[model samples]
Target: MDFLYLLKERFLPLSLMAIIPIISVILLIAIWKKKDQVSKMMLTFVTVISLILLISSLVLMLFTLVIGYNS
Candidate 1:
């Protein structure tokens, strides 16, 4: 039971990381299937959100690298 708990604690972050790509793929499929104006708009919104997330993650990663190097 203790081992399971420890595993879960370690796995939680990894699971969350895995979700981002799944969500991105689902959003891409939705965008591809979208035909009407509202759907297209929603798809565009999702694309923007995904791009923002990508950029933010990249910036954070770069910051972490810089900080790590300085330390």
Candidate 2:
């Protein structure tokens, strides 16, 4: 069940990274329609949040594996 354990460990961050939809069509539409700065700012914010989630989840996974927190 090592694969299952790894999945559990990595799921949250991977899920967070899955928010690319937020940056997808709507973002393109915003730029195409309004050409406003707000959508650009939102894109940056969402991207940062996604990165933070992935990084934090990776750190947690490393801790669990290296320090044996799941033991």
Candidate 1, residues 6-32, lDDT tens digits: the string is 445445444545566567667766776
- Point out the worst 10-residue segment of candidate 1 by lDDT: 62-71
Tens-digit per-residue lDDT, 1-71, candidate 2 = 98677757766654554455445445555555654555777766655665666566567555655454343
Residue pairs clashing, model 1:
none
RMSD of 2: 6.3
Q: What overall lDDT goes with each candidate model?
A: 0.58, 0.58
Model 1 residue 22 lDDT? 64
Off by over 4 Å in 2: 1-38
What ranges in model 1 sit over 4 Å off?
Answer: 1-30, 33-38, 68-71
